[model samples]
Target: MRIKLTYESLDGDIILPKHYNYHIQALIYKTFTPDLATKLHNVGFPLGKRRFKLFTFSRILEKGIPTKDNEKLIFKRKITIYFSSPIEDIVGNLAERSFKEREFKLCNKKIYISQLEIVTTPKIENKVIIKALSPITIYSTLYKKDGEKIVHYYKPIDKEFSKLIEKNAKKKYHLLYGKDAEQMSLEIKPLKFSVQENLKIIKFKDTIIEGYTGIYELLGDPELIYLTYETGLGNKNSAGFGMWEIWRGKESDEDA
Candidate 1:
């Protein structure tokens, strides 16, 4: 894990431990989004590149002979921002400096407010994937609690219901795990079955209510099941929303 330290203002200056490496500093900056990205770019900081050096390590044996082979130690470049005040203040001052075409005063020196560092590892981008599963007709009932306020209840079609009702009942199912397949095949199951339920409601001082409730169910083979769920809620502050999620199963004991 990477750690970041930001001070509001400098009553006194601060120093970093000599042992800390540049790569660690870079990792800290990577945790934030556009703020750091834009700043680094504006300062002409190099991107998608890194620098490092190699050192050799050796082990000595009891017989005074070198036993273990020499190993290489590598270092890379990273960037760290040091400020006399809190992070918020540092960001503000940096912005002000940028707008005024002036440099920020730090550590008793005028600096550009950004630093370049060397790290041991390369940076990676984050990826997200979204998939759709089978759809089912939702049987819902609405009740009014007050003016312009309503609650909805949904349940699965009874097994003994008419064929038409059964055919229309929403087909609920879980997502199954697969490896790199472009298309997925889903097996629908009963929507009423769920392994867990989570519910929360928040009421603001202005009497605006907002909440969320969700249910999860597992499907597929025991060794590679998919989990699925539906969630939604709303109040005076905003209209409620509902969504579904499905994902592959955790590794089995055999894999562990």
Candidate 2:
């Protein structure tokens, strides 16, 4: 089976640290038939006594811009896995079962299995691809009310912020040639939020970048507010993806 995973930055404009490296490792530990275990172990998959081959995999870093108050600044990375057997049969009998039997944590963040899709290739290839979507929500601590006990907070989505987000989600540019004109391109959305006040509060929501998700804290600073957006996937390595890539009002006019 051949699997291709693509990660694209949905929003934000910040550059990720070059030293950051995200790692993705599969854990296959469970009671399996001796034959099956041996097959998996031989391929280098580290499945108890079984092994599996590691095919093509890559990590990509991209950029995005936020258009809303709660929009997320993000960076994206996609991983693809190619196996020798049918993805359904392999993932169903082995992958799914293994994940359930063991505890897998990425970047210390608990992962929630999102979706599994089986894709069929053309006759020339005659292959099947199983795509699994998993997401990890990185949470910070935030107080529900002022002076209240600090608790873990996850960003939530709000529909009201859509209009505001749409109006402001644009790539900003400052022209250096001729008359120093300002330029903007592409409307962006928010994917996640981080709590500025409570570092333990983590929030998730599905909304376009132009929408409003609600306010957590107003620390009297315009740039220090917290908001919510869709969460990204994280791996064992320090490298990961984020949604808040660009600032809401800091779009530049430079040509890429």
Error of 1 at 46 (Å): 46
Which window of ten consecutive residues has the lowest lDDT sum in model 2?
A: 168-177
Q: Against the hidden reference, what TM-scores do the models get? A: 0.19, 0.26
**Candidate 1 residue-wise lDDT, 22-92, digit = tens:** 32223223322446544633442222241111010001001121224422121111123221111233334
Each model's lDDT: 0.24, 0.26
**34-61 per-residue lDDT for model 2 (tens digits):** 4655564555343334222322122222
The C-alpha stretches of model 1 lying farther than 4 A from their native spots are 1-197, 204-244, 250-256
Residue 185, model 1: Cα distance from true site in angstroms: 17
Residue 247, candidate 2: alpha-carbon lDDT: 22
Predicted model with the maximum TM-score: 2
